[model samples]
Target: QFDQTIDYWGGRPHDDAWRAAAEQRIAELRTAPLTIRVNGALGAPVPGATVRVEQVRHHFRFGTAAPAGRFVGTDADSERFRAEVARLYNTVTFENDLKWHDVNPAEQQRIDAAIDWLDEHEITLRGHVLVWNFEVMPPRVRDLDAEAMRAAVHQRVTDQVGLYRDRLYLWDVVNEAVTNTEIWDRIGWDQFPEVFRLARAAGPNIGLAYNEYNMLNDREGHWRRSLENARRLIDAGAPITTFGEQAHQGVPLVPLPRVLELLDEAAKLGLRIEITEFDLGGVDDEEVHAQYVADFMTACFSHPSVDAFILWGFWEGSHWRAGENAAMFRRDWSKKPAQDAWEDLVLNQWWTRAAGETDGAGEFTQPVFYGRHRVTVEHDGQTVQAIVERTPDSPDWVMVSLP
Candidate 1:
């Protein structure tokens, strides 16, 4: 098994330094001060008004890789999957439906339905991969000559990216290029950046990301390769906007400190880093899995350059490593310790809710987690509510006028 091959922290003394640093950074970077102002309909300040601020969503993207089969099907499992997704995540990436091999005419219908559901929920969708230089190519692609393969790839990128550009927040323009070099060898390394150009032209407004695996552990020098490839692509005029690290870990988990170090190094590229595919597949103990999950999430969340933390899968039945039980929930949808840990952090520990009476200036000010908040004020037997987004770029104060 893969677990036996790597070094682990098994039964070793756990250090609290990394956790402390993460907590400090989370407080410093994830919060902002906001002032809520209340006024009467005629523009008089309503002093001592009761004010409440409740966060409705997170600005940071907490996401999962969703299987379209479950999202679009009518089965009980599908219902459960969709419910959990809507409850737990604000962003999603289709597991296999958006990949090169699966984007056929028949699968497009299912993809459309899934996109519709995501739109209705207001969840952000990321296109999994526009190009993966792996063996999962269609039969026609396997035997094509160099020129024909280039043409095929160009057409595929144009068609798929143009089709869903409006709905997607980003696209993995090229995936795992560090290790999977079939396309690189077939089309020449010089043309790799052109693929990103194709995606940029097709999806003018969406972000383009280059995704790779094994950067967290770095047993294979994949992190260095990713950095080198990123520089090459950028130097050659690829408008790469994000760096995607598929943080798939097994039994001997990479230490939290090392993970943070790698993140810092990746952030040096001046691109937003995403923990694109995170899952604990190799650990046997549930408690260990949960702790690692919390630590990994904290490390990622603490980093200012990190934009999103996405789970590879959430349920074991639909998980890629289903045999190893790498998900937070079982096939029956029962919660695991990892799930509890995730919820506690995402919903309770990191969540923001505040209530207070406005001052003589009719202003209530507090530091809050950055996100959309419903601000409610009550005065003179009248209640007024307004939704405001508390981003770094938002104005200093929000105004809610009472009737």
Candidate 2:
């Protein structure tokens, strides 16, 4: 694999300056000053109280594409798969179970079970897609005539989006529309907007995403075509709430500067940008993959419009392309360099876990990552803990009253 991809994408920059700049930007954009105020029942200050602020979940989604069969199965590898997902990701997109081709009674049952597990574990699930004109389409759909094709598209949107309405965080209403235009070609260009309208009607609260590939990695004519199509859909009344980039990269990786520039271009659409399906392929060197992963993540996080970072797959056992060479972990679950880099950033550097004592004003102030946190305060042998969240709109101070 290494020899094959040696000259594939091109030479990646070995400089650290761009990454350093991105990290600095992360410290500015991804965190905010938080003041945890401790007070008694009667509003008296509880100075000197011990306080611990541990982040519970990120407001920024970190996730992977998970296979429903493995997620809901009762085997050892299945157990490992479930455990790894829950431990590592706060969200997941169903790999194929929710797609048009794979949709079946058996798959639906597995999806239902997986939904239950995700809810129980407090993990958010994203519907992979409501419509795709590519390989995942139902076999005979392409052969249908205009009326039948229109009905098929509507039914597909209604069934999946309606079934998982409030359960999913987002849905790829129309995927890969730039290059894959069979749906629109058959039903007419207006059909594109109608599918989004149907999805919105079925699941009004769930975010609708316009997803595509190559826009970020290659960034040639594909990028312009995708952006133009997105504008066309929006102008025709499609309610696209987010832009999803399947940032699957080959060698001669997209540079850090280009990565940031592409994000800026997507941000011009005025919708949140999500790194929907991120993974580096073709390169067999674990170190190369790890560094690029870190660089890409830093670039995304530094951009204000980017909201989520989700891998196409995490385990080599379950990856779609390049198998063992394209994922963070090997098939045997060994720690690959990519896995270490991901954990080091997600679990350590970017995570917030601070401990301190309140001041004379009963306030313990700390700069923290923007996310949900569990705050525990101990005063005079009484312990009080509460779940708190910090966002751009949230107040800097959170008050916790003692018993």
Candidate 3:
């Protein structure tokens, strides 16, 4: 009697039936990981990466996770990286820390590796910089004479551009060239034209951008100088296609309207635009910061002329500006409130899903909408929201929208 009672409690018919059904359903729903594909190329898969899909809720709240899978598409290492990004972000940008010195230190292998990684994962790669007056150039090149420097610049640009000509789409052709006039004076501003010229010659189809900081501050003189330089480059037939503003506001205090105004003016130039490096730091209010990020992305994405927006680094642990937690992820790879805010406002609410419908003349109309519409889409069985708006003739989507 005692043995029979123990068996009944441990393995009752009712409990065993329910457990078997649940296990069967779980096994049936499981997939062998999703592959990352970009432009018809298979991207590397990630393993052990958690992919969470949530719905967009009212007032910037993201819904709970629905369904997710691990990475199993490529080599083990590549798979790991891809899984990492897929778990946290739908979009990823390649960084250039190793490119400036390490890759070209003596050869292009390092640059090639970085490019290969992006290609393998089907990640959108932004050539961090073709020219920056500081922080990028090695001391060896800095010490070169004027002629040698020009030659060096020409070689570097040509080689780099030629190597990644068709692979990379956007480039920061001349970074911070205006911020420090003394450096230009020392290196000879004339060399700047050559840099642009060589890059165009090497990769004419790629988008070339001039990047700088503090333009949003509305410093009239500085703004004028940067614009003038851009105009000169454009007028000279340089492939100056985009204006990249490094919108790293040290504090979360930039005026939203002012930010819009700057973007509007850039549109007038008829060039593609990007908020190349954006980070709003020094604020502890997660809600406010999330709103600020959403608002900023909305304004940029709403503009037809703006193309793509890149968060400098999504994880605080890997961010260059360490002390400040400006990324969407905390140090431990967990999602910060800002991450949810961005995903809700930019991906779910702002992005348009492919709906089946023909707008006119039997042409299938894509789900994309124009002029600041809140987007709601299902990812991983969860609903998310983002604000997306664009005018005709704008090249890329800006992810700046406020709730």
Task: Give the TM-score (vs. native) of candidate 1.
Answer: 0.95
The C-alpha TM-scores of every prediction are: 0.95, 0.94, 0.66
Report the lDDT tens digits of candidate 2 across residue range 192-291.
8888899999998999999999978756799989988888877887888998998988767777788888888888988888999998887677777787
Ranking by lDDT: 1, 2, 3
Clash-forming residue pairs, model 1: none
**1-403: candidate 3 lDDT, tens digit per residue:** 1232223122423212233443343223211111111110132221222222222212111111101111223555435445556444423445554235535342355445555655675454667666676457788888778778777777888987887788777677788767755446766777666677788889978878888787665566877788888887777777678898777764525555566678777677778777777777765666666766776666665555655666776666557764665777676667778788776755555533443321222222232433334433332334435543333434333221112
Model 3 TM-score on a 0 to 1 scale = 0.66
Q: What is the lDDT of residue 264 in candidate 2?
A: 85
lDDT of 1 by residue, 1-403 (tens): 1233334565444466788879999999999888998888899888899999998899999999988777799988899889999999999999888887845676778888889999999899989888896576787887899999989899989998998889999999999988799888988898789988999999899999999898897465778988999989888879899999999888567778888889888888889999899998877777777878898899999999999999999998888987775899988889999999999999888888899998988899988889889898988788889998998788868989898
Report the lDDT of model 1 for residue 131.
86
In candidate 2, what residue range of length 10 has the lowest lDDT sum? 1-10
- Give the CA lDDT, 0 to 100, for residue 165 in model 3: 83
**Runs off by more than 4 Å, candidate 1:** 1-14, 102-104
